[model samples]
Target: MRIEKEVSPEYEIPAVLQHIEARGRRPVLIFENVRNLNGTRSGLPVVINLFGARERLADALGTTVARLPLDYVAREKPLAPVVVDRAAAPVKQVVRTGADADLYELPVLTHHEMDLGPYLTSPSVWVRDLETGWTNCGILRVYVSGPRQMVVNFNIARHTFHYFQKYKAAKRDVPIVLVMGHHPAFYLGAQTKLLADEPHIIGGVMGEPLELAPSETWGSDIMVPAAADIVVEAEMSHSQLEIEGPFGEYTQYYGGQKLSPVAQVRAITRRKDAMYLDIMPGRADHLLLDAPMVEAYLYNRLKDVVPGVTAVHMPVSGTARLHAYIQMRKTNDGEPRTAIASALSSDYRLKHVVVVDEDVNIFDDAQVLWAIATRSQWDRDLLVLPGMMGTTLDPSADDILTAKGGIDATRPIDPHQFAMKLCIPEAVLSRVRLEDYLTPEGLRRL
Candidate 1:
């Protein structure tokens, strides 16, 4: 319940519901207990780092995994926020300037044993492209090295990569905003795959707009909540690079320490009552962010590719990013392969995607495997493509390339003598319940 008081009404209940949905394995909510990292000043305890199970992610999005992708079709584009003054901002309720703004004092977590230092794992960095005037909001890892220095890891293909490339090409340092400790909805909005700039998707999802405020230290660009718990205004020098790695990653493996660009913090603005949110780099954090996003994007990508495309399930074991289970109506014979091709091309992140019939629950891997066993012939259903691009965190992909494979697990209809096809009666399935053996509580040796 620590999150209830500090978080908005929408975030609080869903956070708790995340636990309920997972039953036992869901992410645990941290209650407030601020410990100052400097041994002198401490941050206020706040709830943070919620993720892992599908139920947990579903809670964050306020929907089930099954429905999330369809929601993207709604495409509620957020309007660029109107900037407000610092005095009017609740985030400035307690402002720390220059050295007083030392980030070392915040209780940032050093997630993996090999991490260079304490890192800000979950952040929605807001910046603008120089030539295009396009505002960017996306997630990247930030490692705290000094009071004013943090290391940034930008994937070669990420928006940050393009932005950084621009700066590097011009030999100019780029200044940007790093925001944390706000609504989970903000994180959801940042996951969007659209090429356009949108901070207003939060408003559309919430049925209203989110309030934003300008940074006292930086100009124009508004940070989240109009009162974010912690905001860092940072500049990145394209020429001045540093090694930024050996950190654990979403891929569930060590990213093995990387030498990357450094973020020079110019000024940090925060609430006196700020509670730093520490998201562990791997596992849970990766799941919550990846699952719902994959569910939404894959569905959107494969919808028109295969008719009767109903749901996309990114099970927890697949890291929710690497593997996807696609469900569709098999209107024709080659439909599954078509769905697989579209899905693979949709996002560079997906390594393997399987398309199954409506009878199989995409969410349950067991049923999917069952369909593969009963309905598919190895040669007929399997499709493997050579030399595909891999995601940044896909350690298995070697950063350069990897192979792609998919299975068509739906039962094939007979082209001839189809009238003899058989199935169980719906009424029998609905009415027959073996309470004596099937139910755990019903089974007793005595």
Candidate 2:
């Protein structure tokens, strides 16, 4: 989570990529003097790829990448956020209202060729439920539309969309706060799907309780992270809507233009020198950021039905959302099939699920594929569910309904005829060190 600040005279998307390449693919980069669309320098700095690398993400969570899901599940309880005085909040150092509330001044990036315009790629939106008064936060996409207006797209199934629906029914503007640049834990927490608890509680579980500050325009009930680099206090118009996309998504495809809710900015608050965070669409950072949360959710759900469930992996190849791999210890013959069905049901976005024994490493794509090749019988082990509700982002789906399938890659439980994988003896393998016999060049080649 350590960021390297660059004192560049000008900032652009290409320059950010160049900086990443120069640093040999470093995770985080903070750029000062970000250039606007007119090629004029802006006062605000921009932070990109903050959670790009797995090692950096692991460091942020205080655990190794392999242990992130288990750790997250263990600490997935609600811890109330602490409200701090506006005078003590770093984000309240400078307040821009009325004429100064201009979204164009920030360095929003046009990430792809077909993008509609510059987009705020890393804003975690905060909204309150109209019926329950419970606060909800989600990392949703925002397209910059004007000086004080932006289009916020929400999936119909997401909780944020549900809250917006309530406001739409009541015919009132839904107050919202767009939080940018806080701890990586906050970003990960925003993606978590909690039924009872709020998202900010995940931050408290990870490290400390998130410090809250009342939004200047949205009243005291609408809270934002006090330590955030930037906060956009806005309200979503219940009746007014606009066409918002053709922007790149995590699925590596352009989400076609659609009418989305518009949020008109009432105020913009930030520190004297704020860092605006941006995430690249359809990239590793976008995928892995939500992967651990999804895995933890599936693990929690599956453990209740299948007691032997051990691990869940949503590989990056599946965009870390649409495909799943479940590893479990099979006590009976029907367990693998049940696990496969349960996995597909657990996440509606999942189109393909593969259940394997604990012996296979789900993280390794090759090993999982190998298990399917050797352990699965196409006719007997495959289960297909047709005309199921699928993700809207899936290009192949017809009207968001598609046929999904699962593969039970676990070996037969009766005879146990699968051949054992050959490996060198543990004692001998542990004793051998390349430095003892090989040259540096030879070791590198090996």
Clashes of 2: 0
On residues 1-446, what C-alpha lDDT tens digit does candidate 2 reach at each position? 33335333233453566456565575565666567644566777777777776667777788888888878766666777789999999999989986689888887888877888888889888888988877787888898899889999888788998888899999999998898888888877777677544645656555778788888986577877889899999988999889998988889999899999988899999988688788877877688888888888888889999999999999978999989999998899798888888888878899999999988999999999999999999899999999998888899999789889999999777655767777889999999998999999998977
Runs in model 1 with CA error above 4 Å?
1-24, 56-62, 221-225, 415-446
lDDT of 1 by residue, 1-446 (tens): 35433332113333444455465445455645434446442546644546545555555557765666556446447655556677877677876666677877665665555667667777778767878766677777887888778888777667878877888899988877887777666666776666666566655554456667866565555354575777888887788778887777777687766678887777777777776665655556556665665677667667766657888887767877778888877777788888888888787777888778777887787888877777677788898987998775776676668888888877665547222336799998888777834756555532
lDDT of each: 0.69, 0.82
* TM-score of candidate 2 relative to the true fold: 0.91
| Decoy 1 TM-score against native | 0.84
Name the regions of candidate 2 deviating beyond 4 angstroms: 1-26, 196-200, 414-416, 435-446
User: TM-score per candidate, in order?
Assistant: 0.84, 0.91
- Pick by TM-score: which candidate is best? 2
Q: Candidate 1: worst 10 consecutive residues by lDDT?
A: 4-13
